[model samples]
Target: MTALHWKLVIDAADPHAQADFWARALGYTVEDNGAFIERLLAAGHAPAELTVEAHGRRAWRDLAAVRHPDDPYEEATGIGHGRRLLFQRVPEAKTAKNRLHIDVHAGPARDRAAEVARLESLGASVLRDVDEPGGRWTVMADPEGNEFCVQ
Candidate 1:
């Protein structure tokens, strides 16, 4: 059996902002698809309206992504082959709790509160702190209202 490669896709009102937030939060790098976009445009395979100038280069207007710094990626398309998160723009806003959420663990010897504070500074908000028998953790919401845990 072989393991499959996959990336988590998130729906957001602004994909670029979400990508920036997540990249900073996770210590990841934003994928730069400018070269591929330029090639597409030159080949007349894609319209210019689908792209916008971002980070001083071209990017998809409705999509953005972040990938772990250590992960392998394709140089041509700037697409990560492992540990990636893709954000796509949607017409509507988030209306309810997320069924699936990300859990951020404070690495060894790191302070959870400090991490939470750092995340807050990055536009995340603390929803609540939980001290359950199972474990203690902080629940937080991202800029787009996506819930995640900090432990």
Candidate 2:
């Protein structure tokens, strides 16, 4: 079987906070894997150095995730089976433009201008607005500076 299971992994300085922002922006839910964490702690299988207290709860300080609202998820561990974004802490800041970026498909019913307006209200900023003979799209950045597009 193929080994792929995750949709996307985001690098962040503060993973838990980033996960929270993204969850609200996308109308998604943050995964609550505290049960699994607690179990590991209780069984003495988890290293004490790997856990942290976040938002008055036990959490992994290095990584956190959020999932699409309609996706199927495991109730026990709170991991989703559909589109999800995982954020992991990293020391280095983003130093260059993203070689790989996401395209927001708001559908044909909504054009780029309207989408841009909506996204801007949701904490996205327009990096550039490009119009070419082939098509048009707005280059935008998420709240944390990750770039994406509205097409």
Candidate 3:
């Protein structure tokens, strides 16, 4: 058997903004590496030029992450050690459709329409509504235009 630890990586123009949107969408929490960054700077092990102010706090200029709300994390760095998605800044914009995407299951007990509406309020736009022989779902795009489905 093999052991593996993984997190999805997404490229974005603004990693912090992407992290914020995904955190709200998935009910996740954004990782706060401020303390660890400060420690690194204080010890002269890191460059201050690699840091930025985000969400009114210090954060890595090019990277941010969001993790499942129930997952465990490091206290000092606030970096999630469990299920998470990491966003990194890139020079190029998303120029095409996403080859990989997320499917959000609001479930039968949950109001999918209301959920969609809520997501819309959180900077997601509806791409399309689907009602097919297989099942019904809505295709939506995040603030940065990454496509995801709500089912």
Over 4 Å off, model 2: 1-4, 47-49, 53-56, 108-111
Clashes of 2: 0
What would the TM-scores of all predictions be?
Answer: 0.99, 0.82, 0.94
| CA RMSD per model (angstroms) | 0.6, 2.5, 1.2
Residue-wise C-alpha lDDT for candidate 3, range 24-126, written one tens digit per residue: 9989999989999999999999999999998778899999999998988989888887899999999998999999999999987989999899999999999
Off by over 4 Å in 1: none
TM-score of model 1 (CA atoms): 0.99
Per-residue C-alpha lDDT of model 1 across residues 1-151, encoded as one tens digit per residue: 8999999999999999999999999999999999999999999999999999999999999999999999999999999999999999999999999999999999778999999999999999999999999999999999999999999
Alpha carbon deviation, residue 132, candidate 3 (Å)? 2.1
Instruction: List the pairs of residues colliding in candidate 1.
Output: none
Superposed by TM-score, candidate 1 places the C-alpha of residue 123 at a distance from the truth, in angstroms, of 0.3
**Could you arrange the candidates by TM-score from highest to lowest?**
1, 3, 2
What's model 3's overall lDDT?
Answer: 0.93
Query: What is the Å distance of residue 100 in model 2 from its true position?
Result: 1.4
Native-to-model Cα distance after best TM-score fit, residue 50 in candidate 3, in Å: 0.8
Backbone clashes for every candidate come to 0, 0, 0
